[model samples]
Target: MHDAASALNPQALAEAAGAAMYARDTASQSLGMKLIEIRPGYARMTMPVRADMLNGHLTCHGGFIFALADSAFAFACNSHNLNTVGAGCTIDYLAPGRQDDLLTAEAVEQALAGKTGIYDVTVKNQDGRLIATFRGKSHRVSGEVAPVQR
Candidate 1:
């Protein structure tokens, strides 16, 4: 028997998977992160820098920025509806994020093979100034992110 979900296009499948993941992502939601866009092997998220997220130096904490990028990475890797997790990741901060700055992270898949994939994420401020670059390696686990549906 043919499954109805098998007829869904890649874009539809990705959107469904993203919605399912975002609904359960309490960390991202608590941090005011928004899933702006999602597609096969791509995702974009935004987070606003709040005063409470600032460091002693009066700038947004590096951890918060990293979290934004990581969330984007996660969404992008999982867009295929396959349960994927970050096997490793690295980030380089080029500039500090200030309070009230809206930061956007865009993650793009660089390569995918077998059960592994590489993703590159760029975090920028509202003014489009590059703040940081992140690279993540993803390993696909053994499950679907969401049940296939029509």
Candidate 2:
């Protein structure tokens, strides 16, 4: 995996943060995280709902679900860095997810400006049921590009 810390500067921090923040486990990463697919201007991520990821209802917590979507958003927007951070996000819960279930969130770039971008994120259960939908706004801060950044 490309190490953002090693390769990216401010200009590419958005894309590099994913790999830079990657760890072996969720606890270690502090985010529901996995980079399953990376396409131009898009990303797909998978996060396993561990028991600790549940809420009072014994279902996967919205925070955890958001993490899955957020991580995918981070990856999709930051695929090449350019310094990205979510300015806002809206998520609609379509279905609750279960512990031990693996969920995937896919993010697609919807629009962009020199300083702002929008993305559509969808979280789905292992059976292909739509679990949640999210819209994210990101700010692409200006920064000098790193040489050959990931």
Using TM-score as the measure, the top candidate is: 1
lDDT tens per residue, model 1, 1-150: 115755377887788889999999999999999999999999999999999999999999999999999999999999999999999999999999999999999999999999999999999999999999999999999988988855
* Clash pairs (backbone) in predicted model 1: none
> What C-alpha RMSD separates each model from the true structure?
2.3, 4.8
Alpha-carbon deviation at 124 in model 2, angstroms = 0.3
What is the C-alpha local distance difference test score of each model?
A: 0.95, 0.77
Q: Whole-model lDDT for model 1 versus the true structure?
A: 0.95
lDDT of 2 by residue, 1-150 (tens): 346565544434434455553542355256546787765468888888899989999999998898889878877777654557789999999999999889999999999877888999999999999999999998887752223435
- Poorest 10 consecutive residues by lDDT, candidate 2: 19-28
